[model samples]
Target chain A: MNAIAPSFPAHVQTGALSIRNLSKTYPLKGRPVPVLQGIDLDIRPGEFVSILGASGCGKSTLLRLIVGLDPDYQGQILLDGQPLNGPGLERGIVFQDHRLFPWMTLQQNIALALKNHDLGTAQKQRLVDEHIALVGLRGYEQAYPHQLSGGMAQRGAIARALVNKPKVLLLDEPFGALDALTRVRLQQELQRIWVQERCTVIMVTHDIEEALYLGDRVIVMEANPGRIGEQVQLELAHPRQRDTALLFQHKQRLLAQLVGH
Target chain B: MSPFKALTWLVSPLALLALWAAVADAALFPANLLVPPLEVWRSFADLLATGELQEHLAGSLSRLSLGFAAGALAGLAFGTAMALSDTVEAYCAPLFHTLRQIPSIALIPMLVLLLGIDETFKVVIVAKTAFFPVALATVEGIRAIPRSHFEVAAVYRLRWPTLVARIALPAAVPAIVTGVRVALTRAWVVLVACELLAADSGLGQMIEMGRQMLRIDVVMVGVAITGVIGFALDFSLRRVERRLSGWQVAGR
Candidate 1:
């Protein structure tokens, strides 16, 4: 492990992630039930944005749409200047389940993301190794997903997602399955990684505290034609202190919005 | 895992064997009808000394290999095609299911009539016996693979060859291996039965010859040898199964 924490890269190719008049509907018993309606979100390059909502909210759907995992939607999603039609290496996703291939070791799983990259073998290995180390899973490169704990598996997933050094890293409740202590530790570890990588991160999380802790701006969402309820910007700097009053106040207000009087 | 532990585990089977031996030697039925284990062993040694047993075994094994190879290859291709295309599945599913429902043993007489009591007939029966289980397993295995896996492959923009080589094949390996094991054991039994009914050579022929000649001891030897070979084949297949599915055991 490096004693010197790597600094965030300053010269990132800032891609404007813009969603315009986005909407989604599902066919329920022959009727179209709208999930997300007339939604607009613009995430700046290198910014950490967290979407916080209740269980039935379309927060996850929004992430899926941006990641191009779900393409059936009515509106334009632009990453930088390119139209988002399908999934690409530029956008990486971390699912709720670790989704690591059971047969693959940690290193192999992460390296799979770089399968299409036109890099030399040594360079590819270097990136895989670096990402494994980045997620604090340095020595566990050869460990299978089944051999690892929940937190460790999720870390491996994170490493896999970040191995590509994507323009945007979409997280669909990545730490939702972890225990309280593990979640907290991962949240901190996530911040450290995000700062070092400086990739635009949009995470969908139900936990208000988690959103407040990780996001530069936490967007509260409401269900039943899911749309943004409110947006709260955390003025607190990066490498955030967990118990800060700013984080606590944001959490309380976000909770109020989520639980609606 | 200890020898003593293994020995304790065998107590019931050993007791049963001893009881069987005692019953056979009691002369309750004619000694000629109920051949004793010692006499069966003696017959087996005699056959071995004359090279009769080895010759029969070789003949049976060669037939099994040929039949099983042809059946397994066809089954793998057919199952994969069925899984890949709804059109193929729709056209063939009912016929496939109906054929699978007919036990291979039940088809022996019909197959013999159609193909004659030649080598071709026995090979056909053995192949038919091996085919269905493997095909059914392959289809189920392929279908059981999550759509997410394909989506991952698509996201990476993997070519069809790469996808099959890296993702589909490995993901379906456990099921495919299980199918192969089932087919192997099934094929072994079917070959012996066919040989008993039709073939002039092989272990089943030897057994049939012994029965006709009224050598009850030789008949007993045939039965015991078949049992042992069947057990050995299953044991080896199980070892392969465990080794192939090592990942699954780890997950459990």
Candidate 2:
């Protein structure tokens, strides 16, 4: 039960996220309704952090704020010690409903992420191909979003998000819409991709097992003017086994914390 | 095209032709009014051979193209502006709605008085017909684009040009195309109607001339040609729409 920060490699000096005294309120009928309350988070480079919370706990909202999709929050969200003004190429996100442009083929869709990059055509194609293969969608490059199943579409979205080689990848309950079996499979796939990319990642989810399985540190959040409730550190190495008693123990604790007031 | 599909399209024309011939044989209403299909076909062939029908048809098609191009371009610009800018929308929306409600047919009399039944009036009427539907569709289509797409654009930090070219245009294409199709066909129909009321040359003018000369066969030929040409335009436009929207309608 060490509450200390995890040790990181000295060589890879990128993607350190810092959130300080972050609070957000949405105006509901002319009155300010607090959504996130004094939330502070610091994530190391190349770390995988999962945020778990019930609905309306500001978990997704936190991801939105972190991704710079919503810039109206009170406090600061800094990446590499610099405050973010709006969305940039350094940050990428995967939404729950795979938001692939239905008009573009899978390969074209992935290539769209590289539009702003100053890369040549061959390099862009190589990056898109590599990311498509990274998400295990090699042969289905020409397929459209509607042609692929929900799971495959989400994988394509992941490939699109990662094609830019973003420093921080934010997932807002990415596999929330999939069936349980596909969700488990994608969780493993996501872990592999995370390890390969070695980018800072923050995924928000309600699934207890998913969070504990993928996150190096699981941050549990509480609702009603959403605030961070507790943090659990899983010291296990990559390609984690779901059958571990340690994971089960953490899951039970998280469940109790979430539901037992 | 498959033989089955060809046969399927043939059914309606054949049935209508059969009914027309039967009525003509029975001398219903008068042989003069209900001209037989064979006589109408002969009239069509004679006009085709004499090159008069070709001139009128060519003139109508040229007018359609010119007027539709001008109107559709304007609609696209106006709609996109109104949608993207709140000030434009606030100032123009109510007037746009009110103008669109006044049918193009109803405006013919007033337009004749104002523009004096010339090529300008005809072209302007055709343009008016093409404008409203396209603008309405463009506005709705732009508005209905999923917010997530804009979020994706922001994440990628797409520039304004890239955003419009890639995200905005493609996203609004399906709706815009439907509107364009409606605009084009409506423009054609309204142009013909205007020509019927007043014109030097066109299929509609030919019909008016036929009525004054008591050549019901020529009028019937004009009617049939108008129907056929409209069908052809609509079918071709639909094929274009399908090709453009292949990503959505292809697999499904």
Candidate 3:
């Protein structure tokens, strides 16, 4: 695999996320039902962390909290040593669905994220073009979401999320809706992009192989009032081969732990 | 369209015309009541040549445009307000719903008494007819917007104006446009009915005059023209609706 050099300017390292004793509950039939409890995690800048869990595991909920979508959680989520407020431009996220405005073309959708940024029109256009190219979606700028294939739309979503140059990027099962072949292809593309961007990434997924393949550290979570179960650290380099025995071994170990649960 | 498909469209009209000719030939009713199709056609040509049809049509169309514009614009504003603000909804929704249930025709008598049988009465009635469906659709459309859309806006940190204009309006467009289309056709029908009840000049007034003069062929001409105009209005609006919402995938 040819590794592309990072195209963005080298700014001071900033994205370091810390979640301490985070707990959340949703009201079920008038009583509060615990969804997440006592979760503590500290992530360094430029780290790729994959959170592996089953359905009802609250993994997605954890991401929603960190992204500041829902502010009804208990605990301190500090970003770069400062208490995080509601969603800021520093954090970007991609949901399972592409969520592109159907009325807008790919280029327009990506440009919309820069609506609040203090940049000139030409500068915003450059950022949009660069991100679209970064996601390998050149020559498809004028296509609307419906006109694009499922995988292409998801790629467009990724470009939109990255256009703002957020310090931290979150992905919630970003490939969950794709076919097996498309999912695999997008995983490769995601790996390549992450290697080049080198931003802090936290992805939530149930696919063990995907987690082991991309994550610098994999955190396994258990359901029933979701909590961390175990952690696995992968001492691997970028542009790593997908079919390596090391990846297979880690996948097997994670599978055994999850199946045993 | 294929030649065969185009031929199929004419089948029903031809069948109806043949049936009418047979009935008239058999003298199933009085000749004056069921005028021959040829006589009606001649009357249509005479009205066209004299420009009486054009005058009545222009009068009716102008009323429709003015009334529909005022009513649809008000509906859009009021509906958006009701959807956005709980206080507005709470105060107005009940009265709005109750008023909507009463047909515009029912209000014609009261409206005539208040505003007289003039252009104002017809315009007011058409405006009232246009408002209800549009307001209802706007409320429903805005409410139906998925929460996911709002979440995306939140994540992007979009400001208020951006959020409303870019997100909310576009998301609710298909519904609002559909509502406007319904309101327009409904207003046209109500405008004609109002003219029928009382008008110095209009297609409806022309039909009434034909009835008084025992010119059944003229009445038939007016009826045919009315149907054609209504159909043209609906068909054109449908095209606009399809064009505006071309982004929507079928079955989605």
The interface RMSD values of the models, given in order, are: 1.4, 1.8, 1.6
Clashing pairs in 1: none
Which stretches of model 3 miss by more than 4 angstroms? A1-12
Worst 10 residues of 1 chain B by lDDT: B152-161
lDDT of 3 by residue, A114-157 (tens): 99999999999999999999998999999889888999999999
What's the CA RMSD of model 3 in angstroms?
Answer: 3.1
**Higher-ranked by TM-score: 1 or 3:** 3
- Which number leads on TM-score? 3
Residue B160 lDDT in model 3? Answer: 76
Q: Chain A only: give the TM-score of model 1.
A: 0.94
TM-score of 2: 0.94
lDDT of 2 by residue, A79-139 (tens): 9999998998899999999999998899989999999899999999999999999999989
What pairs collide in candidate 2? none
Model 1: lDDT to the true structure = 0.86
* lDDT against the true structure, each candidate: 0.86, 0.90, 0.89
Could you give the DockQ of candidate 3?
A: 0.63
Residue A232's C-alpha lDDT in candidate 1? 83
